[model samples]
Target: MSRGRGWAADDGSAVAEFVMVNGLLVILTLSVIQLGLVLFIRNTVVDAAAEGARFGALADNSATDGIARSVDLITTALGPGYATNVTASTGSYLGHPALTITVQTPLPLIGLIGLDNGLEVSGHAAIESLN
Candidate 1:
């Protein structure tokens, strides 16, 4: 008599493998998106710093003006409340008048724990003294 009949071998087990691969792909895609956002914020902040430094390098530059310009540039480049606690100072670099601008902003991220320090951006440029 024939033993207990059993079904033939099947390849249906690939479904689980496919699902796992797709899940990994999805996670990778999200990670890429997050990295892009971080890069964007970094570039935007750098540009703002450069702009502020340039403005502060002008002939009629002052500490307040530098800070204001930095704030405006950062706010415009990023968005409202993006730049906060900005400080600008004047110093000498290579025996030339230099202006330094520092700015801080918070990064936008989901559950960005332990980031209470936020982000900081700064720029320094030689001031063109119109004497």
Candidate 2:
């Protein structure tokens, strides 16, 4: 059995094609996963901030309490590192008194770690009163 002259020139091309395709697929998959991770982290942080603001807006609670609550939520969900930069303040939102909780966290470039303070989110809740 003999092969054609053109077949010899095309030998080993499959291996090269497979490598390139595989590389591209791997990169695409990793990119999708990373995007999902970023979204998850952002949502978690946002929820924590909102919950903290609501908690702090309670008549018996204060801005400091809100900050503590936000910190605790983020710490438990992600880790202590992400919770370090949380802050809370009392102010007016939509013309009504409110509490705001702001969270600044890493941008998560490569698996749960990235540029520090690259992302920021805030949550606000109306302040409760007994009057």
Q: Candidate 1: deviation at residue 74, Å? A: 1.9
Listed in order, each prediction's TM-score against the native is 0.79, 0.92
The all-Cα superposition gives candidate 2 an RMSD in Å to the true structure of 1.9
Once superposed on the true structure, which residue ranges of model 1 sit more than 4 Å away at CA?
1-12, 109-114
Q: How many times do residue backbones clash in model 1?
A: 0
- Across 1-81, the per-residue lDDT of candidate 2 in tens digits comes to 877878467888999999999999999999999999999999999999999999999999999999999999999999899
What's the lDDT for all of these models? 0.75, 0.94
Pairing residues by index, what is the TM-score of model 1?
0.79
Candidate 2 has a TM-score of 0.92
lDDT of 1 by residue, 1-72 (tens): 545435754456589889999999999998788778777877887777778888878887666777778778
By TM-score, the best candidate is 2
